[model samples]
Target: MTQQKAVLRSDGFTFKQFFVAHDRCAMKVGTDGVLLGAWAPVADAKRVLDIGTGSGLIALMLAQRTGESVAVDAVELDEQAAVQAQENAAASPWASRISVYRDDIRHWTQRCEHRYSLIVSNPPYFTPGSDCATPARASARSTTDLTHDMLLNCAESLITEDGYFCVVLPTTAGDRLLTLALQHGWHLRFRTDIADNDRRPPNRVLLALSPHPGEEFLDRMTIRGPDQRYSEAHCSLTRDFYLFR
Candidate 1:
């Protein structure tokens, strides 16, 4: 187990077909990114866009899911992280189908030529005024740099008429994000509340929204069971990404 940790440490984390390097990025790989990458409906998607793609983890996961024919593009505002994202994608088996850019989504939406079938973001949702040692960490976690309005406007401009936008957020921010999404002509298409255990309140919400309203799909997921092992549902959702799961 110690040796296994060392290997994972060297490679960041190993996925079925790719490895993500997050040492230089402010945000390391986490469950939120994995859940959003897998839960998103990408089977029919031809062009996918990932915003704020720190470490390129979620984008790489999506690239694996979408296949070689589908094009996946990601944008990261942090320059160092963007470079790391580009490198990660370049090293992946699906390298030819993935592209990473060092640009802000707000600006990218203005001139984006390709219409995306799906757009995703595990956005920074925390409000300002918290203490964080690193500027990058604070920027990644707090909305002082990125607001829900910015993300929604970019999605509205870049997504196809029938396309979907997916995201995962802490429950507090997720509700507010959903409210904002509704105001801007985006409606919930699917939703799943995520809890660590069956007994605990949901800490995160995975959401998918489309331009047209439909019979909203809803579900709940518990990450761990009574035995303190991964719940079956959680394992199934992430089996493709986690090594030796």
Candidate 2:
């Protein structure tokens, strides 16, 4: 089935991203990407890799926050999304520092020789039996496109010994992924659980893992407070990327 396309305008953050057009992918630029981008670690990273780059949102965010000191590379499996990502990168202030490739993460890792200080992915996390309204959506949300094992393997191969691997996934799959990481000898460094509001259970887990880690640091972030307004923690976490604090 043919995928439907959409054009997304920038939210006027530092990155000022504009997704010209995209199809054949389930996910688009949304709150998840923004939250992940703003929350990912970027303090001392010299080189970064973004897997399943999609609209290149995370790459742009890293570029905006890191300046030209850090080089960012993005990998996308979908041809259309890759093209759009390149365009978005070119349009950004850090165009010279960002590069987008139309390749799968598994293939990219096999050919990658340079090691990254940080790797981030807002990957496909929906498990089986979840509702998928369309083929494109299924491809966007399912692990079939890029399995957890594939991501972990790439992380092990592409990241340096001291580098960090970070991702945001559904809470259900997050624990399982952490288990898989432990099995692969990777250590969880930091974690944050997210909920829509104070009343709801955490639906997403944001994690940062590394090879040189002692003990995992776990935290929680509630997106909204009891008033149904943005929580102070959430606002602070996203203040750098969002137009309004």
Candidate 3:
């Protein structure tokens, strides 16, 4: 849980398998990011790509999840965030398997030569009228930096025929993504609606899109238990990485 704090490192957060330094990032590590990272399928992943890899969290997670031969390519546009992501990757146990790029995903997608077996992104989701103050935060929150069409088109072309592109979005913003993916010939093969607890409604949606349209698998995840502690499912999903879990 991003809501849960790590053993306070001087400049980073500690996990059971890795450490992340996000103070230089506009967007610090959050639950949505961590959840998307852990939940993204890596069953048979060979080469993976992580777009908008803030603090290199998801890329590192994939490195930790994949077989020893798998290599992870992560892209970040933010200069400071990219550097921090690079540093984080270098310090991790899977340092040699992860590479951090300091470039915009839109541009990076153009130059990227590798076709990934799995692609995951946690892009900016704030719609047109949000009260964001700083440029970094705005870049992290607003969609101006990376559009749905740009991400989908690139993913459609770069992903393997059997590959899947997964993303985490706000519940409301997911509608546009669903529509966009269909328009681009990608299908929503799986989705998970996430909520804080069993009582409250979902606020986030995790989507998995693929070139081949198949039966849509829908599911739900609650982060906390009735007693307000971490849920069994949440803990189990993240048990491999989180120390407290």
Candidate 4:
């Protein structure tokens, strides 16, 4: 498939993102990727994998945090996205440490030789019966692209015995994912519920899972206060990467 190049402009950065110039993929680089990129755990990680690495945002962020020695791989099913992810990685400072694979996660897992110390994803969570305006959006948002059971199975197979699997998802879908993880013997290690503001209910959940037994560390994070400004905690959490601070 021919790849079409595009550009994305945010407050702090201008990025060239590639797509099938004319294809259907519901998601583009958005706030969700930024949040997951900035919030995922990476300390002392030797090997990491970014599943469904749409824009290579999370992999680049990991590169920024980890040393040059770490190895990072990203998997993308969309051909255009895979190309774009490679372009993004090449343009970043951590280019030498990151590689992009244009393939399905299920197939990639079968041939992967080494286990990753960290596995992270911002997965498609919208389940069946949800409202979707277009085929692209449905593909990007719905579990039809990658089911929860499949994600769990892949994580169980790809992650090392002590590795951590981190993900961000809508709170509604997160509940089902947590239940499935338990059934598969993947223990929940940490979780944070995120709200747009203090007055609103949580819309997203960030979670870390592992095979080792441990109690869950649960917390809540509100992005904004009543003043409609970023909360101190939010700023602190993302200050390292975000230009707002």
RMSD of each: 1.8, 4.8, 1.8, 5.4
TM-score of each: 0.96, 0.89, 0.95, 0.88
Tell me, by TM-score, which candidate is best.
1
Better of 2 and 3 by TM-score: 3
lDDT (tens digit, per residue) of candidate 4 on 1-245: 10111233331244222121212234665667767777777885889999988777778887777887899999988887687778777877777899999999999999999799899999999876688887756766778879989999999998988889999998988888999999999999989899999889999999899999887799999988888777888888766665435
Error of 3 at 119 (Å): 0.4
Q: Tell me the lDDT of model 3 at 22.
A: 87
- Per-model CA lDDT versus the true structure: 0.89, 0.81, 0.87, 0.79
Model 4 regions lying over 4 Å from their true place: 1-25, 128-134
Candidate achieving the largest lDDT = 1
Deviation from truth (RMSD, Å), model 4: 5.4
Give the better candidate number (2 or 3) by lDDT: 3
Clashes of 4: 0
Alpha carbon lDDT at 81, candidate 3: 92
lDDT of 1 at 207: 96
Native-to-model Cα distance after best TM-score fit, residue 174 in candidate 3, in Å: 1.3
The candidate 4 region of ten consecutive residues with least summed lDDT is: 1-10
